[model samples]
Target chain A: MATGSFATSGADLELVGIQKRFPGFTAIEHLDLVIPAGSFFALLGPSGCGKTTTLRLVAGLEDPTRGSILIGGEDVTHRKPFQRPVNTVFQSYALFPHMTVLENVAFGLRRRKMAKPLELAQEALELVELEHLASRKPTQLSGGQQQRVALARAVVNRPALLLLDEPLGALDLKLRRQMQLELKSIQEEVGLTFLHVTHDQEEAMTMADTVAVMNKGRIEQLGAPEDLYELPHTAFVANFLGQSNLFTGPVLEATSHAIAVEVAGTRVLVPKARARKHSGEVTVGIRPEKLRLLTEAPPTTAGVNTLGPGTVTDVSFSGVSTQYQVDVPGADSVTVFAQNLDFGPVVTPGTEVWVSWKVDHGFGLEDSASEEAKFAPELDTATIAVQAKRDLAAELEVS
Target chain B: MAFAAFATGTAKEQAPRRKSRIALLLLLPGILYMMLFFLVPLVSLVMTSLQAPVEFGDIGEYETAFRWENYVVAISTYGEHILRSFGYALMATIFALLFSYPLAYFIGVKARPWPLLQKLMLVMVIAPFFISFLLRTLAWKSLLSDEGFLVSSLKALSLMAPDAHFTGTGAAVVFGLTYNFIPFMTLPLYANLERLDTRLVEAGGDLYARPATTFFKVTVPLSMPGIVSGVLLTFIPAAGDYINASPQFLGGPSTAMIGNVIESNFLVTNNYPAAASLSIILMAVILVMVVVYIKRSGTEDLL
Candidate 1:
């Protein structure tokens, strides 16, 4: 909700009406952003959603087709990459193979003709806890070490802005988790603007002070991580940030306090402000973890819990939590998550159950399922993000 | 349990040994070919270089002996030719590098957005090689004749005296070497630069290196494998090339390279020991120079 109220005195990175078209494809369109100085900002989106393009534009590697790029209130749209006060830690960790780790970290300072390049480079290496590997070439280091060296290389410059394009994407799951905390601490220690672009929602949530979910060359949603997760403005954000069970319905009353909507023949009340669309039709959404499942049907109370009559279709136990899919006639399957604090009568697949959640937890969304159908053929978009995350876990098996 | 662990560990170690044995078997042909054609010839040449020439015998005959004086005699007799060969080869290698870097960079990097243009330019670079270089050098001989269009144009421009010609000059031979070996230089350079991680260069620039500084500090050093190979490909052969400096071709007596000296000693003069000694000397000098050059360039892993 608070968009432009962080770190007012320091240099803020601003993008105004930026558009970039590559030949026949438009990578970015009418994009606007304000990354407050000294705050960690993340651009989270699937591949080909313009997140990387936006990062490149900020890094001065790619000039926007139209609109301006301002770093620290200075227009650097026309400047070359070196002239801009920005640095990028590329996804591949692109540590210069030919240079020693120390030389790689010292390169930026040496280019700036700063004195005591070695000392500053050593300090930067120590920040990443990789000072001992200074004499080794980049190829000698493991993937995680290379990643930290790249981080040190970019952060050593002390640029007004540091751009990281999937900085931990190549590391193992355990290393990535460790680096996420390390990176957050490093950002805090440096007190400089860090713009991280990643497709992993957890990474964004774990590190960024603000997360902007980008899709289809535009900003789909931008807010604090919890806000975006709990009250997504669109079905895409609902599905992307985490799993959401969508129930399509017609809006019956757009009251000031709550918007009444009929879902699966059951009347549901959503917080009025949460109803992004006040029109006739809206998609009702609830997180699986927020829903409660009961074996016996309960009487529905107005302005309270909304209950849907259904039969449990599937029950899957995953150690910490048990998930259930309930088949409600005339509606999609409703999913509910139950934490295993205590065991009771197990809900079997053929048993009748009631899926209920609080009124405030249910929110209305502007129809994004139609957009999903239109862009559904790009299903690998989902698999790619999932695969990249899964690949980290798989890499741990190798080590 | 520990015995089983040791057994499995030893089995795992032996598996790679078997794999490497297969790898060595796969390399057998190459190793045999090198030993047969290259190693044998090299050893024979070194022995012949040390053989004493016919003493109070037939003019062209020689006997096998440990005549360490052959090297001294060969160096003293063909010192100018030896130095000239290396100088010309060095100049040609430098020219090839200077000219090929830009051309290769253009074809491989600049023209990357246009696949058709890249393939076309590569073909054009290679098209000249289809015609024999001997014929091309011969064509150049005519083109640089006193009355040829090139010579006439040069005369008109006053860049050359009207009576002067390019056919037999040392410049002509060096030019010939550069022209003949340009493709060798360009292709490898193109291959290396084509696969160059543009991201690394971008990273260098992002780290605040200017474009030119990046070219020297990053681009040039990264492209070193190509440079080392290209220089070796051009310089090694150019140092021992007879065709470029033969009197009938691009050069006269003053431009005689070690190859020409060897050819004359073997074919015209029929002094086989002198010819063999010169060839051995040329090979030894080139090997030393290449090792020193590769070391100086600071990339021993390239070799």
Candidate 2:
């Protein structure tokens, strides 16, 4: 659909075995990705997870140590940033401070010697709804306004792909939420391959059609947001995408359709399709929201897993949901998020409760040692998981 | 009286008042110093600029009279010297800016990855300050003398006439001024460029600007404040400099500037009124030029 003049059919971007290394560390370790034209794709990860590095490699700001980058079957690996048909909306919204908003928007067009730069820039400003602030310098505008100008500046070029490196990071919570929807709509309106890099999982889930969970310079999982949230392949993906209550156990029996795993002296069945590793040891995981917290022991139902009859250690009340931490005898403390559907007396600390979930909801992760060997050559999985958890905790605190 | 009222008032209400009193008290010494040193001398100089030579008195004697025509005589007698001084200063300022912008960019932006190199280069830029300015100018005088290695080599290479020389010329005096004020121009530019956000340059490149285009459009415009300050720092003192244009230094009598004229009038001819009027004119001209320069640069809001 011809929504506006800025709409142009975009070309797909491909990164073939790209690797980037700094002086003492490797930022990206063999990244291979292909973003389809006109798709909203997000590289979701914690800080320092190579997501931004990947974006920069595509933008031609940094050269890959070992592989080629292609845009629409053109090898642009050795080209300069200006020679490549890519533009970036930087995390700091690096608009030229000396120029007015219109001038900043027209910068790329003017550099390319395009016709009617001012008209195109004004149209782009109107697209971002900042036409009234055209004559004002960048410093005169607020952070959100500057962010819009940066977006308009990059979008006005109609590059093959648009790179957004945490573009909403500088905005407040309210403004960030508002801009997330606006950015998604703008992507659709322009129909360009938009590659967004962010640490906020919620932003990635809400804005992108496909989210690639990245960790420790590798892609942990790539799929639709719902699929990734429902069936994570690694502990990093399961814990980082959202809170996952994981239990390390050995596989007692494996069948074509299911695997019976013994977790904390209790048998839990996982669907064969959901478990990445069905034979040896595995870490079974279930989302906190999927598990139910009941005061009595759950009945022995087929195709169900129950893990508690334990004491409630803590209770936290947020507006929409109440979070309960239950301590079972065999398992460590488990987190359960209960919806605020009941108006009765809230559950207090030191009360007994049982945590239960359907077997279909459980997804199994391979043993940590093997997972570590698969991703990194030297380090173990514990260190990466702890780092990811710390980063996620810091991100949560910031939000 | 205000301090006494503050002390006697209620403690809660008078605390802010007492603090303000202390702040004013702290400013007393600076105010006294300015009044005694700057304002008093400025007023005396203005008075002297308007004074007349004593009637039928000795050469050095002058009387307190409103002879404003002393300024007219000063300008008429040394109009060419005043023009040459400004022209040399403008040339020196432009040359220093051209030399320092790249040096500062290299030191502040390119050498940033190796901070030790950045610091080392900055120290090198300011290292010439350790020697006395007069001694340095005198050294340059010898280096560009008729028989010196530079002139001799140029003559041998057929690049200059056999009888040509470097000293006793406008170019030599301008070169000396430019050399002496280079650090002044470089440091401010370095500080400004060091604080510039390099991502903006990268953004320029990402937006289809070539490297040269990015340097001109993104880097230079953002460093305008530095350019303006460096120009002022170099031009103001270069205009009033006497050492470079003194007959014993790099220049002859034909190439004398306003500073040398004022010096000779006060020392040799004992024309105190002429010297004082020329000094006042120099100050007024510099003030007007600086105001216009700052206004044209559009950095008045920064100050």
Candidate 3:
């Protein structure tokens, strides 16, 4: 709904027609974003996807080759970094190595001419719960401690906006998860617009209100984390945000409410709203967790569920969930994640099963063949087998 | 499994032994070099420094004896020169650091984007090293001569006292030392500043630090290791330099340094004991100064 109206008046950060080009590569191009006041926003993308570049443009560390950066409705494109009412938590934490923790936090406040800089710095450290280590230098602190200091350093300034450039990337997984919650609580308490840049989809989904998935110098999709996870517009977003099983083929039928896409021998019914383009030769997608596995074939009832017979190629029990790889002959291998309710027959490799999911759960996708090519190779061998199976199934089903 | 564990244990034990063997192999040439050039000469110098002149013998004649008075005599006779040499060296170190820091900063940090300019500036810093240090000091002598173009022009512009000369002055000697050791100061500084994490500076700016504040608080403090090393590199050599302060170069008899005094005792006067004692004193003094400087450099805990 934030995209519904062009409300520039209260937008904490606005980047219009932002483009950054280095000597040989365009880091960002035609990027336009408006982050509303007090909203937590994240730019989620892989490396070289211009998410970091956009963050830098907003941070005033880089000049946009072609556009205006307006912060709090003020045109700050020509302003220096220090002149802007914004700050950043760098990926490396970039704490002043020479200064003590208290001194580091006090740095920005002192520059801003606070009346009681040390008192305010102590308050900031207490916010991150690191007041006890105030006298220690940055190198003396642990990775997690340094991260808290970095967060304290930026949040202490109380800028109109704060940019976190993968601030938790240096921590271990457990510490990262803990910091994620801590950062969210801090962001909520401060009520400042947080512009976080991260490649972690889970982190973005867990903390950010809005996530803009970037790829190859462009915003592929931008929406609420739930909306993006549920209704991804591009193949890149669907695959990058989480695991996705894509079925690209000709459209068999199209209606206002729904589009039936024929993939291999099975026809997938996706709501028209989910489809980026409801036309001929489109790609249909579904999430791994959305797919259901059944030992017996369900009734071939229309609108009930779409079904495909396949052999269980892999079964992994991950305590809470059991992930299955089902290979349909002449079709791609499909991934199905089922909760471990401990209520069904144990599915193992080489077992016969039917892959089924409701029609409404399937989503539509646009041209993702290129995006698929770039990130698809990083998928494990089972996923590749699924793709290979799809190719064979396409030829077999059509004939 | 038990046998494999035993093999792993033996492999672990052998690994350090192999490493030590390689270390010994690597250290053999260095040990040999130090023994032949440094340790042997050091022992001979100690013997010579302790030797006394033969009673009622010729001025140059001396014999090995426990005459610790050679050190006392050396200190009393050349104490002024010793202090003057260190003072001039300290001045040159400070001047070289001031000159090289900005040059290194501009080239290594600012001109990094322009590859051609970086190469050109680096070449300019190192080009002097390709020429002999003595020849360069001699060139400076000619340049600062009373009738030379630089001095004559300065005289015409009234920048210098009309009758004041630079060729034999202490200022000229210190200036010569600074110029000769500038690359020593610049290269180490450039090496450290070049790898500077620019993000810290940007972080400072993002934290609302003004440009000047960022430079002093973040950039300069982070470059301290470079400054300390550069000062050490320049000071150590400048203190021991002889030719730059010799009368044939830029110095006068009144402006003689410890190096010039030691050179005269060894080659001109054949006073071996005096030369040896003065050399040892200069080494001891420079070592103390270097250690004290390092302690106060604020980079003690850092690598």
What are the candidates' C-alpha RMSDs? 6.1, 6.0, 8.3
Alpha-carbon TM-score of each model against the true structure: 0.90, 0.90, 0.84
Tell me how each candidate scores on DockQ against the true complex: 0.47, 0.47, 0.48
Q: List ranges where model 3 is wrong by over 4 Å.
A: A1-11, A113-119, A129-132, A265-267, A300-302, A328-331, A344-353, A368-371, A374-399, B1-57, B61-79, B111-120, B155-162, B265-280, B300-303
Worst 10 residues of 1 chain B by lDDT: B1-10
Q: Candidates sorted by DockQ, descending order?
A: 3, 2, 1
Comparing candidate 1 with candidate 3, which one achieves the higher DockQ? 3
Candidate that scores best on DockQ: 3
Among incorrect, acceptable, medium and high, the docking class of model 2 is acceptable
Off by over 4 Å in 2: A1-7, A172-174, A342-348, A369-399, B1-21
State each candidate's chain A TM-score. Answer: 0.91, 0.89, 0.89
lDDT of 1 at B67: 84
Winning model by TM-score = 1
Collision count for each candidate, in order: 0, 0, 6
> How well is each residue in A1-399 modelled by candidate 2, as lDDT tens digits?
111233267778999999999999999988899889999999998778899999988888898999999997889999999888888999989999999999999999888878899999999999778999999999999988999899889988888788999888767888787778877877787788889998878888999999998888888889999999998888778777777888877899998999998877899899999988987788889999998888888789998899878899898988788888999887788999888886522679999988899999999886452354454432223455577789999999999
lDDT of 1 by residue, B64-129 (tens): 888878778889999999999999999999999999999999998889899999999999999998
